[model samples]
Target: MPISHQKALPSPIRVVLLNKPFQVLCQFNDEQGRQTLADFIHEPDIYAAGRLDRDSEGLLLLTNHGPLQHRLAEPSQKMPKTYWAQVEGDITEQALQQLQHGVQLKDGLTRPAKSQKIAPPKLWERNPPVRFRQNIPTSWLSLTITEGRNRQVRRMTAAVGFPTLRLIRVQIGPWKLTSLQPGESRDISGDPQIATLLKSPKRKSYRSPRSPQR
Candidate 1:
């Protein structure tokens, strides 16, 4: 049966947010060969709102709601997302300014962003802790972006000469990582505001022009 016909069935779309863990592939298949979201979310017919990279860890939204999914994932929408990054060198005032103004990349210049130095973070142990080079010092930074480009944060930090060692997304629009730990999943039925945010807007009614009477 076609998906449109299957709509008569009982299951309805719902919204979900997940804190994606490092090393897990964004997809459900293992053909290319790696752990995937299928290892976490098990609900039938559900899909992710957007994606996070396999090497990156943090807040990811998922939903069965199609319109909500399109709205969040579409590049034109430019949803805001914040990240905490640990980079390879000391964070200088000049470096912070450059990041705020936007760095040019092969794709073109990024939009202006908000950035600042942050205190060292206490995070879950990465399976293979990033390689250590004693001569180079590391510092923590907070950065936010309105666009979700491919490996964008990492590329941005590297463009500024501070290769990111650790990257964790902390916020997206109004959603937050809060208390959820990596590798864990949850159903988000408790928050009404979140529910409303995820709900699809009602479509406008249409009327046809009247035909001549016999």
Candidate 2:
């Protein structure tokens, strides 16, 4: 019998997760020489699926597949992103309800979201720790929303009278920031479970689109 030759399969698309640190820019390059993604990640040809503000810290997904990146980043896809936020006030039930029901912002009324009180998440200290106010107490809340409007989370908290002191993204779609310290990165390649979740159709938003009044 003749020897059989088999071609090697190409590597599946790579998905990199980084526990983005506070004050770090989300891009690979910055003209001002500020800390950027290149300071922590050195992967070739991979780009962030979405961006994290310098003031926010936590899970940031990067990938090589353009379509997959768009699916994750596009707001229209409506993937829920979860965050643990430490707000200045001891959040009241009414405020939590307000956050859940959506508050009116300068831009417009936001879609209803999931919000609840939670114990502060265990994590590494921020390089410049959040200010501690001796007289005012702070509380933690877990907020999940399907939109990614610029500074939306901060604005939402402020609108409800509980200004966020610290915000950390804990989950996005099928990925998480658990156990990954600040500035650390992990490769979640070849995980079929996550791939399925990523490729799954977007979850329909609970709220119906407002109909125009005649």
Best by TM-score: 2
Error of 1 at 97 (Å): 1.1
Q: Worst ten-residue run, lDDT, model 2? A: 205-214
**lDDT, candidate 1, residue 173?**
83
| Colliding pairs, model 2 | none
TM-scores vs. true structure, each candidate: 0.84, 0.87
Q: Residue-wise lDDT of candidate 2 within 1-214, one digit each (tens)?
A: 9988989886569988999999999999999999999999998989999888999999999988887888788777788999999999899999999989988886677888999999876778787889988999999999999877788899999999999999999999867887899989999877675578666887553332441221
- Runs in model 2 with CA error above 4 Å? 1-11, 197-214
Instruction: Please give, for residues 1-214, the per-residue lDDT of candidate 1 as tens digits.
Output: 5656545565565767787888998877889778899988888788888888899998888877777787777655667899999999998888889889987776677778999999997888887888868899999999998776678899889998899998899888877888888977667646575567556464343211231121
- TM-score between candidate 2 and the true structure: 0.87
Candidate 1, position 8, lDDT? 55
Q: Positional deviation of 83 in candidate 1, in angstroms?
A: 0.9
